[model samples]
Target: MLQIGLDAGGTSTRATVVTTDGECVGYARSSGGNPISSGKIGASSAILDAIESALTRANATLSDVSVIVAAMAGGSADDSRDWLIEPLADRDFTGTVAWESDLLATYFSGTFSSFGYAIVSGTGAAVIRVEDGQIARTSDGLGWLLGDAGSGFWIGHNVALAVMSDIDGRGPSTALTPRLLEALGISTEGARVQGRSPALPRLITALYDMRPVQLAQFAPLAFSEPEDAVSRGILESAGSLLAHSVEAVHTENGPLVIGGSVLAQTGRLAETFAARLAAQGIEPAIVRVADGAVGSAVLALREAGVDITASVFRRVTDSVARMR
Candidate 1:
């Protein structure tokens, strides 16, 4: 039997087909939009295209697939499961499907041996806690408007604020403002003003990239010297918010796993996060997921009837390594 796993992230949708033994058969990816904004029909079409591409790569048909598991941003326990069930029920695909938050899928796939916390920091940030094989608590997955601290959105938002302050002469004159202006090839503050007018939110988007951290170098800007104070403050705040999320669900002791592009690429944030957590007397095992997409695939297999054994874990890990 084959298991199909899909990870629907903020920027793209990824799908993978893996065998019961944990060998990856095929994988495909394509751009996808937020279902909450685009409507279910639009979201489903994008996901279906990705799934079809993956199965075609494996030289397999949907009929040959026995199970499906999807991990999506903004996907809930019920709505996520319905994507496959409702679609497959019409005979377009054939599978047993389950839906879960991407964080839960990643958490269950890794750290299966112990209770722990998982923090995902990418376009956004969210905290998940697993206890005795169940989700014990969660926090701040509310997206850009409400939560998602220490995320790309957060960094970008703060950078914008800092620049505005500098423009008004109310904030410290940092290297970021000039550096950003130069990067954008704008010679004067007038250009920045023009970009922010009611008609130009899109043009103003690049204004946030002035800070090194905002540039997503995640490293040199956050760790190296000559960094602006506002950038440092942003990093510290993000890490601290992540640490606080962990503490909210943590007991006296448990493992803490950090996942996503931001954490995986930047060691500075991890170090800062560890130090902050330690202040609360909690030391966490900070590790990046070798492959979150494949982790979702393993979750699909486990849900399909594979036993969670030492050998099974090794097989899943090996498959992810080979594919990633």
Candidate 2:
């Protein structure tokens, strides 16, 4: 029987159909289907489209699949779970279904262990504790507006705030101001009251127009000159926050799994994260996941009655490598 795994993000959704023996039969991608990011109807539609596309590519139908595992973002557990389940049930699917956070899938895909702490530091940041393929608890990942304390957005947002502070003479001088202004392409437009107003107001307006993802582009700026005080402070704060986010979960000692651009990249942040976790008596295995899609597939295999032997895990890892 075929098994399906899905990774649903704010930007897109990917579906992979694999046989019980870990042979990849089909794979397809479609538009974003994250219910928290995309509205319910929109997310549901995209998810359905992606699944159907994968099945078609495999010369199969949903009925042929024995189980489906979905890793998704931007929806409550119960609500997002229904986003896929209710729709697939409508399509006459009668297989086992597992719904969980995309973070959990990433953690599973990154390592062979069944229990651990997975922390993500992309545009947003979060800590998830996984126990036997189920989420025990979580912290952070509240998005840019609310929390995401140690994420890329947090870094970039703080840099912007620092720039404004410097401009207003409320903070010490930093090299990031001119660099950021240039990156954002904020030029000296005609001033309010015929050039009487200072340039800071327009800069604030410019920052407003840019979206969260757009702002996230500047995250790497903090690492450009790691020795700079502002960059050092930001990175250190981020690392400390991440350490605390995981510590709050209090999971039994397991490999600390790290994901996302900030934590995965070779930089001061990653270094500091290791140190901070060590302070808590936690060490990490350093599994860098390029994409969490394959982990979803591995989970689907588990639900399809495949025994998770060491050899089986190897096969799952091998399938991901071959597909890549």
Candidate 3:
């Protein structure tokens, strides 16, 4: 028998088809599947499209699958399942279906352990404690406005604020100013030609016109010039906040899976987070994951009563990697 694993995230939806023995047979990706962002109808359509494409690649149908495990961004909400139920029913799916937060899928992607902690720092940030493949507790997944302290949005917002302050003669100058201006398609020379006085106002207008999360576009500027004191300070502060979030949910030593762009990438933020954890004597086996679809597949295998030995985990990872 075969199983399907689905990771329905804010940016994309991915589906993986795997045999009972953990070999990945097919995979496919589709557009964003977050109901909160894309609306239920759009998210469901994207998810179904990804699954159908993956099944087609595997030369199989839902009837050949024993189970499907979907790890979604807003999977815990009361109406979240509504995004999938009708679509799956229409496809004539008869197998068992399971739902979980994407956090769990990310964690299992890195390790087979049922107990561990997960830290995600992409456009938003969150930390969770996993017990028996479920979230036992969580911290700081409040989106770009209220929280997400160490996220890309947090870093980018700080970058924009720093640039504004610098332009207004209230903050120190840094390399990020020019870089951010270029990234925004704002000609610095034109701003200067139009008179430095109007530059700040123009920037304010541009910033206000964008969706708040679009601020995350400037996050990479922090790493562009690693020696800039202002950028360094921002990253350090972000790392501290992430460490604190991890501390809030972490209780014992188990694999600590860190994913998402900010924390998974090897750079200042990841280094600072590791240093802070070390300072607190909270070292655990650290696993980094770039995608959660494989983990979702592993969860589907587990639901089908397959034991996830180290060799089995390696088989799944190797097969998925080859497919990619």
lDDT of each: 0.68, 0.79, 0.87
- Structure candidate 3, residue pairs in collision: none
**lDDT at residue 213 of model 3 (Cα atoms):** 98
Show pairs that collide, candidate 2. 36-74
Model 2 accuracy (lDDT, Cα): 0.79
Per-candidate clashes, comma-separated: 0, 1, 0
Residue 285, candidate 3: Cα error in Å is 1.4
Query: Per-residue lDDT for 1-324 in model 2, tens only?
Result: 999888888788888888898777788888987876787789889988988988997899998998988887665644536756788899999988887578977887777677887888888999888887677898988889989988999988888887788777788777777778788776545655543335677787888888865677778778785888887888888888888888889656877667778887777787777788788887756677765677788778877878666666677778656654
TM-score for all models, in order of appearance: 0.82, 0.88, 0.94
| lDDT-superior candidate, 1 or 2 | 2
- lDDT (0-100) at residue 138 of candidate 2? 89
Off by over 4 Å in 2: 77-91, 188-197, 211-214
Superposition TM-score, candidate 3 onto the true structure: 0.94
Q: Rank the candidates by TM-score, best first.
A: 3, 2, 1
Please give the distance, in angstroms, between residue 71's alpha carbon in candidate 1 and its true position after superposition.
0.8
- Cα lDDT of model 3 by residue, 61-96, tens digit: 988988999887755555647558777977888888
Residues 51-163 of candidate 1 have per-residue lDDT tens digits of 88888888998889998887776765445555446876776665677776778666755665547888887767888888765567888877777878777667656655665
